[model samples]
Target: MISTLTATHIQKSYSFEGIEQTVLSDINLTFTQGQLYAITGSSGSGKSTLLHLLGGVDTPTAGKILFNAVDINAMRQTERTMLRTKNIGFVFQFHYLIRELSVIENVALNAQISGINSTEAYDKASQLLDHVGLRQEKLKYPHQLSGGQQERVAVVRALINSPTFILADEPTGNLDAHNAQALMDLLLDCHKQWGPGIIIATHDAAISSRMTHVLNIKDGVIL
Candidate 1:
């Protein structure tokens, strides 16, 4: 199978105290379908930066990112947005769900945005929520659910679009050990069933070891 995501000679930098500080330097990586990858680094190690670049949330200062051999850096903003909506799904350390919406509503929002009819989207969302084991919590608001339940809802939302790749940054960071393990298992199960490229940025060593492949990032370089 073809690589779902690739970053070639990527470099990123930002201004700090009026001076440019480099985060990543000459980084190169590729991820194929059905692979679960872990990217780990210290607080300022640029792991999240790399994830953002791969997800098209941020652009690299140098080098190119390709999704299925199409240069993402070259695409116009609108084109990139469309591609992201269709191909990439994201989960974060915090479950960024709408507080006002119920779990099912939050999950269905993405499908609805993708032009899926309301009834179809709701049906798909309900099924996904059930798959994530949040069916009973579907009517609950964000705050009404526990941390684990909210995170499950977030995963459902991410998967609702049936994206080709899933990018997660510290997805289980806020959970306890048991909850974290459960979340990891759920993520892996989804990857196994759908075969989307799953790339996660995390600081937990225990979780890192569970990945199929692991990349260590230090001073913005993969080690």
Candidate 2:
């Protein structure tokens, strides 16, 4: 399997009161295509921070992230920005939908931002909404939907770009047990269908067990 993502000697830190707080240290890992991988750890375990660095959403204090063997962290800011927009999709604990947009509209927003026409974006959005079992709620605003339904919409939105990788941070953190399972199933379904490599930061053991491989992050390194 070809590697979709590669990281080596990754170190991230922030200065607080003239002291360096290292969130990650000497981390190395690779994620290949068609695999779902989970990073499980406690709340302050740097899992989310690692995910951000993997996706090029944040720069690491040191080391490199490679997508298709190209070093993302070494790229110019403009290049990395384009790479992120074109190659990666992200989801989070909260579904940050625009309050004014309906479900379908929210999904279409990603396509629109990527320069797709409104009609075509809407068509693809409709298929995704239907796939997520939310076709009936297409016209409803995010505020009008339940938490799980809104999360489904968020997932649909994440998949609209047809990205090469999907990075999710605590995706089920805000859901009830039933809803969390449903959301996890939906994510795996999409992962299978889309064939994008998945790197999820999750605390749930059940969710970790469902993935292809599990990496436990403890004290800034994967163990």
Candidate 3:
């Protein structure tokens, strides 16, 4: 099977007060298309760091991250940005929606950035909103929606560009059980309908248990 993502001898570190701290070390893993992967670890165990590296939001200090066999770290900044915009989707713990923008506008923004025309972008966003059962909420602002509704909008935004993979970090951390389960069901439904790889960094056992692969991260290494 072809790998959607691959990490080889990956390392990430930060320097503070003239001391180097490693967040991840010599890590290696592969994520395949149409698969759901759960990355589980305690707080401060570099789960988010790994996700950022994979999504091209950050670069590793050493080694390589390959997306469809292309080395993202080796690409120029513009190239990497284009690659991310076209092929990677991100869902964070917080719904980072612009409060001023309407729900459909927020979701359409991603597609617009990827060069889709305004009418087409909004149409696609509207369809995605309907798919997530939020069609009526499209004209509402972020502040007007509930927490779960805001997150559902974020998911729609991430998927607007039809990415090859979705990298989610603690996506359900702030949600109640009912909303969390609902969100997970939507994610699984997306996986079934679309073939994008889903890689989630989560502490929720209920979420991890449902994934096709469960990886444990301890002290920056895959265990």
Per-candidate RMSD vs. true structure?
1.9, 2.2, 1.9
What pairs collide in candidate 2? none
Each prediction's TM-score against the native?
A: 0.90, 0.88, 0.91
Flag regions of model 1 displaced more than 4 Å. Answer: none
Which runs of model 3 end up more than 4 angstroms from their true locations? 1-3
Question: Weakest 10 consecutive residues, lDDT, candidate 3?
Answer: 186-195
| Strongest candidate by lDDT | 3
lDDT (10s digit) by residue, model 3, range 119-150: 99999999989987797999999999988788
The lDDT of model 1 is: 0.85
Mind giving the per-residue lDDT tens digits that candidate 2 earns over 1-223?
Answer: 4558989899999999999999999999988877899999899989889988898888899999899889997799988876666677777667789999989999898888888999999999999888767879999998999887887787778778877788888877777888788778877777777788888899888889899899998988889
**TM-score ranking, best first:** 3, 1, 2
Best by TM-score: 3
lDDT, candidate 2, at 91: 76
Q: By the TM-score metric, which is better: model 1 or model 2?
A: 1
